[model samples]
Target: MWIFGWKGPSGFSASSTAEEVTQGIDGSALTAIVTGASSGIGVETTRVLALRGVHVVMAVRNADAGQNVKESILKEIPSAKIDVMDLDLSSMASVRKFASQYQSSNLPLNLLINNAGVMASPFMLSQDKIELQFATNHLGHFLLTDLLLETMKRTARESDIEGRIVNVSSEGHRIAYSEGIRFDKINDESGYYTWYAYGQSKLANILHAKELARRLKEEGVEITANSLHPGAIISTNLMRHHGLINTVGQMLGKYFLKNIPQGAATTCYVALNPQVKGVSGEYFLDSNIGNPSAKAKDADLAKKLWDFSCTLTNPK
Candidate 1:
């Protein structure tokens, strides 16, 4: 159970709601693409970003569900510039197609919120024949970012506004395999554990941001890439695969877990807050710069993971 803890340096704590953390931030000129925008914290994050006057593009797997969410948000904020685009983060072809479609629209992208992810499910393979959790959570976003990075860079150069890429990682990153990532054994189901695979995917999220931040910094681009733990977000459909755990969580969630709004606060803060303007490559918790596992900070591991992802997604 999480009590209202001490506020971080950002004057926000685990109890802070998304709207509370982003008060008075006018993002009228900014445009954002939030993956998984139809469900869970993704919905709240999309709602809050739209409330701040940002033109939000909801990148979701289900166009129907996405439109439902968009309509719901419009009831609250009729002026919101929101669009729903179909995006299945579990499929690389779907990612590429969505990116190409987005590029054809000639819309500027000031933010890319890679918020889509799957949790611990039984061992399965993606359409790409890679481990399901790693493929959807890490590789899909990896390819999507690679495809849209040029657009983000151009938008920053033309608009003179810094772009932000927020990767919604989790505290489960600490529970990955002893090696953090299993590069050689990624598809070896014989040795796989569901939760550990999920942790590996989350850890990969942080490392992706780290290495990406480094590259963008080297190029002198006005874009920041950072990752964060959105707190213990157990109330969502993400727990559907965890039978007993899901049951226990629902029964005790009100007392123990952060509510959906509170769970989304960190993502909103990292994406739109002026305080995070120049910050890059850092892991955040409770809307403040927080330390990640040492493995997450291992620059070598970050580079290696970046290379591995490139090989899988780019394939040059």
Candidate 2:
């Protein structure tokens, strides 16, 4: 059994709500983009950020679903500032378009929560003919972050607000293929297992965050990048693609899983907490910095994955 220790200095625990971690914090001047903001932890994250008076852009693939979420937030927090924007992470074209539109809007980006992802799904190719899980979960956010990075840096410089980038990774990152990432054969199906593919994508999320943090520091940028596990959240659409055995496990494991609020707490903590002001490239869990799997902490591998991702996203 996995044991979660004390809540540490944050005074928050695995059961803490996002609102609890962010209590009394004012976010009126900040603007954030939360991908997959339609439902589950994404929606909860968006709602809590909005509650704290942040101007949140709900980046979702489904416009209608995004609108509904927007309406729901506004109904509760009558003064909340929120916008619905269409984003399909599976398509590079869509990612480019979304980034272009947001850049042209002249909005300052203070936070980017790359919260969208796919789980264990049958093997499928994206529009770019790349594996679906890696494409959506890693490459899509990689490209989106790359395109908007300058905007974030400029915003931080002008507003003197610390820019934050949070990648919602999973603990399952440890379960990837023996090689970690299959650079030469991303599309190979001979040994493909749905969970392994999912794990590879998640591991990429961590590596992407770590490398991003290093590069930003090298360039003397104030933007901080970190990744996290939201804990095993129950009843989220993220599990829609789970296999039968996994589905059964989820059902049986429901009692130990986090509800939506608790699941979103760590994200809120990492994104808004003053305690983590200068912290970067760390993996967080249960509202505190925690060590990830040994593989997740391999710096050389992180850099390698960064190079591979850049090549994929920025083909010559």
Error of 2 at 250 (Å): 6.7
Task: List residue ranges in candidate 2 displaced over 4 A.
Answer: 1-5, 243-254
lDDT of 1 by residue, 66-96 (tens): 9999999999999999999999888889999
Poorest stretch of ten by lDDT in candidate 2 = 1-10
User: Among these predicted structures, which one has the highest TM-score?
Assistant: 1
lDDT of 2 by residue, 41-100 (tens): 999999999999999999999999999999988999999999999999999999999999
Query: Tell me, what's the RMSD of every candidate?
Result: 1.1, 1.8
**TM-score of every candidate:** 0.98, 0.96
- Residue 295 alpha-carbon offset, candidate 2, angstroms: 1.6
Error of 2 at 202 (Å): 0.6
